[model samples]
Target: MRAPGAALEVALQAHPDDGFLLLRTARGAGGRPQDVEITWANPTALRLLGARVAPPCRASDAMPPDVVSQWVARYEKAVTGPGRSWTNGVHGSSGHDATGSLYSAAFFPADDGVVVHLRAASHVMSALARDALHDPLTDLPNRRLLDEYLGMALTRIARHRHPVGVLFCDVDNLKWVNDRLGHAAGDRLLRHVARRIRAAVRDEDFVARFGGDEFVVVVQDLPDLEAVSALAERVLAAVRGDLTLDAVSLHAGVSIGVAVATEAMTAAQVLSRADSALYRAKRQGRGRTRAFDTALSREVDRRLTLEADLRQAIERQELELAYQPLFDLSSDTLAGVEALIRWRHPSGTVRLPGSFLDVAEETGLIVPICEWVLATACTAARGWVPAAGPRFKLHLNHAACHLGDGQMTAHVQAALDSSGLDPGRVVVEVTESQVLTDFDEAHTALSALRALGVGVALDDFGTGYSSLTRLQRLPVDVVKLDGSFIEHLEHRDRDRDVVRSVIDLSHSLHAAVVGEGIETDDQQRVLRDLGCDLGQGFHLARPVGAAQVSAML
Candidate 1:
């Protein structure tokens, strides 16, 4: 008869599946087998184990740490116990099959050790691969897969000379939903939106959940720009509606930005252009679509440069306050000044608030910039002596984003305390639409400021939708009529009626009225005749520096 080892090797070589022979080692401390040595392996097993090896090698040296531990325990039980067979689900971690494949490993007792067999689980591997590329929440392709698909589309564009369009979709008011409703509701809304977008697109198109509240769609073989626009419109229509979440009704909307591929553009460039157009759409107003154009590209570049420069404007002391004098129409004397922020660019050009305020608000630079304005204005007002009254008011415009938060009140208190300026002599100016955006939060914020003895002025009145009752309920001390109404005040009867009605209503509410943007003498005269209490416009005095304001006082 042949030897036991030689007989076993001959049988393993004839076996079709992967097989290994592990020999038992003497127990070190405990009354159990210490380890297993890899004494023999077939050709198939050698491939799985990474290389051909001689017998009498430790299993730890041949297999991964985790794999060795599992096999060693089985070897100990098979050799030390009642010589029973065992089977286990093991993960392959060696060279050739290291893609985290699941394998069924069987161990059977031999003369002095155990023989092992491994068979892969193909279905588990497929599921793992699928889960790697899909988002768990929406079951849509994730950013990683989106990038891969976008690359493929770009390649197809180059080869086939066909246009590929990319649509960047951003969900509007998702944050509001998340804040008011629960996160579960938000997740449900996202999943619903993903399904709708997928249903709205063509079968060939690819849709993915790019990130939080944002999705990207890749369309291949688009013929023209109009087709891309039509697709965007379809997506918008599909997402726009009332969604009832947990017994609460909410409106779902999305802003889409579209960009078509150029032969010279890279995948990143195309996506970036679409993102730029999406930003433009949001700025114009959400729930719309915008296409990328040459002009928009230039505008985006300019805005980016301005944003970068504005981030450094405050630190470099390039920012300064320009005081536009607010005059009392009754006495024909200076009553106070509205503090306007100016950016003295290093290029020797002075930039107005309109030129960069939007960027400031979007980038969240407005918070710090506004704090600086408050502090500087209060300090400058400390040196001014009123031309007629006990003390002239300092009107500072606050951004809408800064309102509805207690931080605004804290900023005002700190400014007054630091500058030693009287709180009663300070007026915080906010637009009408800002107050109406979230009336309750704005009310709470304004009430806190009022408790500090600071006055509130509703700037840009008549420009937004506000009812008489809403206006009456607001804690406003002064109502400044918008510049548009004053622009044609002398010619338009409707403008006159609006102004007269506002003045009357303001007086009834015990609030003062100031007509804004009085450019011509006729406009100022008409406003004064209509019983306007205060006036501010270029006709009276343009915005000037602190020294000029002091001289005027």
Candidate 2:
């Protein structure tokens, strides 16, 4: 029976200001006791306002000092009419030092003499705010809190104000921890974050967790980037302390990104710069700090966007394949076509593999992208094979991870059969890196494809890890020399020597070599004279779809 009222009380306590809104009030001085006062204000604000807080606290207590001034200034206009005037300044907790977040304000009646009404609802509001501003597990401020502080801090410093330093830090692979140990263990690691973060910064400096394992330290009154860098180093040292997980000694490192407050920037701009610097440090092999710079931000941002764009492309199904002809150098005839995946965006722009393939490889989307490319290319090949002539080939590059895919062998067989293209007419090009990463799987897949009577080419041969070693054991039939090897033909001592060795190596292994990037007749003549068996480049024929190939053949 008491539960109903208790719940009501809890609700009211949660948002005392709602009482004014929920309870009907009379106009002017003749109103009832509760209705006469504002509803949201509560004991907390009443205390802050230097008044004894009463039952059914009014909502007016949320007003801050500045807001109270505005109200008092506008009191004449408000009391002369019916509607309440919204206060501007919020009343904040006395506990707030410089970095504190919650600031409460109130709605007050226009009359100067009208009693101040405090609402109990601000407590509820404050609780909700605290939750939103902080990470649940670590109870540390997230990016939002950092933004508010950095904004105010910079604002204060604008009029020849004091200097400030910020340390942006990231955890090295919390994902690995979550995967290997468990969420509990990951939470435990994050729980110890504050102490380590604090230990790295001075008492006067500000610290907050950005998210997951990333944190930021904003230090006011810093002289320059050098001082800021010192804080980053300290943060690295502090977080790198050995951690014990299930009786195992584990070491964790902090990749600190630092951005100092500047007069020309907003809070968002400064933090963004710091994030860029942090990325640079991570790229430099983690466990260190890098100062923010414009060039660094651009490169990091470009790579970051490329990675993100590649992932989004998969979800959006925004990829296509273009066919480029492989020339038989001796006959000057188109022997086969390389099936290169291109990102044809919904936005109507086309991008080459170089723009995003590395991102695909890193994020493991290479497998799916490769799968889509092979299937689509084979389908197109089937449509044009009869008209384009017999034994025309579509060469598709496979990634290091694709070999490990359980259904890839099946995917290949299906693509070939469905397209009505013979397995012999399709060439599976495996990049050197792919073969090295999972040798056993690559061997198995290649052997299976060979059994199906498909042609397989080892791509970018000289660039892979132990290419020659792989050749001896793998089921490779052709070797496509990477373009990097072809770039060095002019210097015989270095470039020519490397090319000669690779050619000799490929020949010794009995694998036909295809020189890529033969843009000029000189490059082509030189490559063919050097005993290269096949060639591919613009000078032969640029990559084109089936329609264009119709005219060429």
Candidate 3:
């Protein structure tokens, strides 16, 4: 019979994928095997290890630290134990090649010490490459692959002089689906939409997931602008109609923004224009397509400039809080003051929250802005004298995004602690539509706020799709009736009935009902008769500066 070392040497010499190494145990103090020395290596082992010199070198010098440590442990076990063979997988630079390839290493006891057989894992490398370029959920190309594909399409456009069309498709009502049906259903909906979108576009056209409910489709060699528009329409039609997820039927729709590449445009520029158009389509009502044009380009530029300015507006002292007083309807006494933010633009005009809040929320600038608001509002409330009314609270409206992360409670606590204001006198208000996006998360956040002795109010109630049962489940001390419900209270029976039911329900739940937007005396009278605890609007008080509010108090 052939010797084990000779057999291994003969068997692996011509092997293409396997590498073999013969190692002798290197002992230290007390005869413990501390390391190993490479006595012999096959041609494949030398190539894989990127070893420049021949064997008779220390394993530490021949392999990476991690690989050497692993091999040393296996060598000790093979030499000292029952001579049982061992096999395991490892990942590191093969030879000096730093490619970090995966390998399966098998160990066997040898006459001198141990022998190791290594096999390259080419299939695992291919899978890793595939995962890097594609979305695991939808199995579609991701943004990175999209960029490369777009680059190729742009190159084709440069060579052939044909326009490349890019469509930015955003799923509509996805937040609603996620909120009501759960995220698992939302993911199923996304996968379903992905299938429809892929089926809609031509095989040559590239479709990629661009993160969150957004997808990008690139059509190469488009003849004209009309072709882009037609493709957008096809995508819209493809993703529309009813789809069932988790046994619940949902109407699916997407808003598309179309941009045709110009000769000088880069990938980012094209995508930006398409995104701007997509926002326009969403604004114009969803399930529609809008093409990028000069008007949209100008709008995008203006928005970018505004966003940049808003970033500095806080440091420049351009942002200020306007306090609007909420009244106790029964005695016509001031119950509280709601702090509303206003931007005194450098252009000599006062901008309402409506003018720039959307931008702030989208840019994630709302967090800092809100922090500033909390500090300022708390400090202002702390300055109020006995005349401000001992029981009057300070209400501050918070964006849902600011409150969702479980950090708003800490922020509010910090503001209150710094300003030495009573948490009992503070009420944090969140809009109904915003709160419904993630009700459980909102509830947890609100519960934490309430635990701190501050009150929580569901603002703009009846504006959202939440039912009375949902309202009953929320942790709130107050419910602010949406202005729409109170707008036609004097003339519309439906509005009056809805307002009455909301107040009755709120009161039964031990929550105060505040009627908002009381423009006329009749609205206030009806609200008071319906047992609304408080009211706020232009008729009672317009939002004013801190000085004005202090003076009034």
The best candidate by TM-score is 1
Task: Put down candidate 3 lDDT per residue, 1-553, tens digits, no spaces.
Answer: 1234654655465454578778786545246655688888776677667665777777777777877777777777666665264332222222223356556666776555577776667644766889999999999999999998888778766677889889999999898789778999899999999999999999988999999999999987778778999999999999999988778888999999999985856788889888988999997878999999878888788889989999989779899999999899999987889999999999999999998988898888888998899999999999984567877999998876767787799899999999999999999999987787678878888999999999999999988888999999999999999898888899999888888898889889999999989999999999988888999999999988888877877
User: How many times do residue backbones clash in model 3?
Assistant: 3
Would you estimate the TM-scores of all the predictions? 0.77, 0.53, 0.73
| Candidate-wise lDDT, in order | 0.83, 0.69, 0.84
- Residue-wise lDDT of candidate 2 within 412-462, one digit each (tens)? 887887777778788888878777765776788888888888878888777
Better of 1 and 3 by TM-score: 1
Model 1 Cα shift for residue 156 (angstroms): 3.0
Ranking by lDDT: 3, 1, 2
Worst 10 residues of 2 by lDDT: 89-98
1 or 2, greater by TM-score? 1
lDDT for 230 (candidate 2): 82
lDDT, model 2, position 262: 62
